[model samples]
Target: MAEERLIIPKKISNRFLMMIGLGLVLLVAGIVLMMIAGPAHHDAHGAAAATGHHATTWYERFLANLWLNNVYFTGIAIVGVFFTAVQYVAYAGWSVLIKRVLEGLGYYLPVGGVIMLLVFLLPIIFTGHNPLFHWTDHSLYEIDGPNYDPIIAGKSGFLNIPFYTIRLVLYFASWIFFAWWLRKQSVAEDLNGGLTFYDKSIRISAMFLVVFGVTSSLSAWDWVLSIDTHWFSTMFGWYVFASWFITGLAATTLTVIILKQNGYLKMVNANHLHDLGKFTFAFSIFWTYIWFSQFMLIWYANMPEEVTYFRERMGGYEDHYTWILFTNLFVNFVFPFLVLMTRDAKRQMIMLKLVCVVVLFGHWLDFYLMIMPGTLRGDSGFGLIELGTALTFLGIFLNRFTKGLTEASLVPVNHPFLEESIHHHV
Candidate 1:
């Protein structure tokens, strides 16, 4: 069968415009809501008496939102390339029909990477008042100073600005290189018509997997785990990856559904949808397993340091994160598990779409829980700031994503397994 190239309709274009416009309005409003309280935080004594104690500044809260969001969306973008690379390495045939969609999701990587670097820098540049990462302060390492922290001093060799900056650059550099290289090979294969590009992609993908094995984990450690400064987890790397991977799977599935509904991706069928649903279903369970293992181990160990992490999240004087922590498990695990359990449900696009949307928001909340608790002690970070910021990010991501789809056929026509994908069945 001949592949159909995407010619984005006027309505879809208009829809994205409206989405972007609405996002911008909300983003402006969220920015005001977040920053409106900025002036009150500055005081000679350095404590806001109004909130009594532990009253974090609005900039701190804003930076927290920015940091978590940068990490969250960066994971989403990298996992796109990661998913495609995995498909290639496994010699997977059933996913060929949806491969371009994955590629489009991935093309958002360079943008996300730049945004991450900028967000990381913003905390340091803003009068050296880093609410998102308290460890970044140089005073904490001064042994003679009143602000001295033995723990932070000990970890300073790794957590220092120069080393952390290098890793940030390298992670994005490597990830971007792989994303670009594979995309180039894919386009070459489409033009030249051979297995040469395909085999080359496998080799490159294998190398990428090895690189990712190290970087993804370390990046997670740097970006999210280090926020708490004192807590550590063996399960954190995979835990973050699971949320990212499954969220990418759901987003990819959702994009395919939208394209099909708009009268594109002609070779894709219900069987393809079912396969996508199955991947989403399986990964939701996988994510749950990782989450539960991490939680249960920490709960059982009862170690002061280990338990402190969950203690803050599970209970506080404010009890801020307790509900959202449980809600994260339910949304990411239970909802998908129960909804996508049956064969019929997997085959149904409506069910798949529903699961995908919820899973996306669920993982957003998951990241919110991870980062917000560390930055702001008394309040839940589940309001306009998060929602508007995410929508703004979505609009930017969609613009890049749609542009990528228009650059190539929605179906990769020259793929060796294109026929297998067209006829894919459960």
Candidate 2:
């Protein structure tokens, strides 16, 4: 049998282009808004400085911090796509139907890298306040003052500007290389039908997984945990991994459903959906286990530093914290566990779609809980900025994912396990 010819529809490409264009515009607008606001804030503070009454606007602080957090959180999502692709490659499954979706996500790795690099370089570009990370305050390292955090001072040797920049470069390189390699193998398999590409990918994936494990842990610590330098959790790395692992799975499942619904992926049947649903179900449990383990350990130990992290989250932001716990457990754990426990539910499109949506939102809330506490505490309002940033990323992600799907064959025609996948059962 001849191989299926891949063709991306013009409409899909155009839509993707529109989404990218819109996202770019929003990003530019956000930057401009901040730039203008920065000077006005400085002017206001300057006037107050003369009278020895420093006036700082809450709105200005909120916007600045919100932008910083958005950049970091989005980086997590971008890294997530690469993690998902690595898993698929390692498993060597007949996931050709979703390969393009993963590839589309891979495209963001470079863009994400650039965003992170820029965020890290902000202190250098502009002598602005370090709302997101306080370590950027060089004066703290120079003087042993009351305002200086001892913990940050202790880690200064490793966390200094030069080392931080070097680590960031290494992380981006590894991700870009892993994404490129995996995609290259998949594309190569299309031209050369055999297990050679498969074997190579498996080896590469194994190596990449080890690298991913270490890099992901350090990345989480550097980007999120370091914001609150006084606190540390051994479970933090595993916690981050669980969250993003499920996030990647949820994203993959959602992308597949969208394609199937739109008549783009006819070859992907109920069987594939069942497999994806099982993964979604399994990971939901995995994420819950990690969440519980982290929380229980810290709660039980009652160590001041360790416990303070949760205290800030639970006490300071009681409402958001409680809602987050409920959503994480009910939507991510309870609903999926019960629904996907059955053989029939896994194959049911409507049920699976519903669960998938919940899982996606659940993970989004997971990221929110993880990030917001450390960054924005007092008034973490769900305002236009949060909504706009999320919508912008979603629009861009969907556009790229769908267009990438159309570029590759919906089914891996020459894959060794293609038949097994097509006829797979619970």
Can you give the TM-score per candidate against the true fold? 0.94, 0.83
Please give the TM-score that candidate 2 achieves against the real structure.
0.83
Using TM-score, give the best candidate's number: 1
- Please give the TM-score that candidate 1 achieves against the real structure: 0.94
Per-residue lDDT tens digits for candidate 1, residues 182-206, read 9999988888888999999999999
Clash number for every model? Answer: 0, 0
Task: Name the 10 consecutive residues with the lowest summed lDDT in model 2.
Answer: 44-53
Write down the worst ten-residue block by lDDT for model 1.
42-51
Give the poorly placed runs of model 1, Cα more than 4 Å off.
Answer: 34-53
